[model samples]
Target chain A: AQSVTQPDIHITVSEGASLELRCNYSYGATPYLFWYVQSPGQGLQLLLKYFSGDTLVQGIKGFEAEFKRSQSSFNLRKPSVHWSDAAEYFCAVVVSAGKSTFGDGTTLTVKP
Target chain B: GAGVSQSPRYKVAKRGQDVALRCDPISGHVSLFWYQQALGQGPEFLTYFQNEAQLDKSGLPSDRFFAERPEGSVSTLKIQRTQQEDSAVYLCASSSGLAGGTHTSTDTQYFGPGTRLTVL
Candidate 1:
């Protein structure tokens, strides 16, 4: 069965520090990839997505992701993290139409 | 201008009871989806609808789960005889879309504030 994996369940980073959240997927072909952020008591918001083209994809809120076909990974990154950036980040893959499989999210805590 | 909305932001029902959750997609959206999110886990796909047609329901965990988009605008997910395992946040998402195959940047799913369902 195809699956999405986010190894780190919780990560704590100091404000203004660089951050990276890992994501890996097991699928037959290259699928559409996405990153979403969910704040406490809120629904998810799309941060970025990767359909095709350049491996490096920039998304909203100063976030970017790189899709590595060899590694089967699409890791989310931020040059400088802010306090507001503290939230649960989810990596998802759309293997087929109308189907999106999400990995267990990584909860980031930005410490002052 | 407005995003997707879901009704009854929170629900609590006793085990063996039935419950219905509602989702209102953004206007003009052609695709609707429902997902179940357990604590500390990402949302899992439950079912999907395009317009008024239910295109895929393969993700539904059991027969007790039922979902429908009656008018292509609003949808409902019903659980018969809710179990303790059903205690999770139910999420609804909508995208300006056409059935499938065409994968474009414009067809992005916007999610609504999920409804936290608790089974006692």
Candidate 2:
């Protein structure tokens, strides 16, 4: 079965600091990776996706993720995080056309 | 344009009761999906529908859970005789339904404000 794993349950970082969230996936075939951000009481918003082409995919809100095939990892990174960036981040992979598996998510807390 | 939308943003149901959640996908989306998210856990896939055709429902937890998209647009997820374990946020999403060819997966999926189901 295809699955996504996000190691960090929570992360605390000061405003303007760099942020990195780790994600590992297990799938038999090539995986279509995605990063989503969900603010408190809001729906999940797609930050970026990696289907093919460049391994490093840039997304909205200055987010970027690198798809490392050998390690089965797709880690999200932000050079500088804003205070408003504090939210839950989810890493997802599509097992099939409409079947997508998500990680437990990592809650980012930005210290002001 | 409007993104996905789900009705009854919050629902409180007693154990053994029935509950229904609604989802309206983005305009002209051919693929719809349903997911369940437990507290502090990521959303789990529940079912999938492509143009009124339910392609996969393997992710549904139990027989008590049912979903439908008769018009290939709006979708509904119904739970019968709900249990405490069924309490979670029910999310709905939609996509354009394009194939990923061989190894890759399909395109982006837009999500709605999930319906928080609380079984008491």
Interface RMSD of each: 2.1, 2.6
Candidate 2, residue B16: lDDT: 100
User: How many backbone overlaps does candidate 2 show?
Assistant: 0
Per-residue CA lDDT of candidate 2, range B1-120, in tens?
799999999999999999999999999988888999999999999988888988889989999999999998899999999999999999999988653353325578899989999999
Per-residue lDDT for A44 in model 2?
97
TM-score of chain A of each: 0.98, 0.98
The per-candidate TM-score of the B chain, in the order shown, comes to: 0.95, 0.94
RMSD of each: 1.2, 1.4
* DockQ (0 to 1) for model 1: 0.61
Model 1, which residues run further than 4 Å from truth? B104-106
Pairs of colliding residues, candidate 2: none
DockQ of each: 0.61, 0.63
lDDT of 2: 0.92
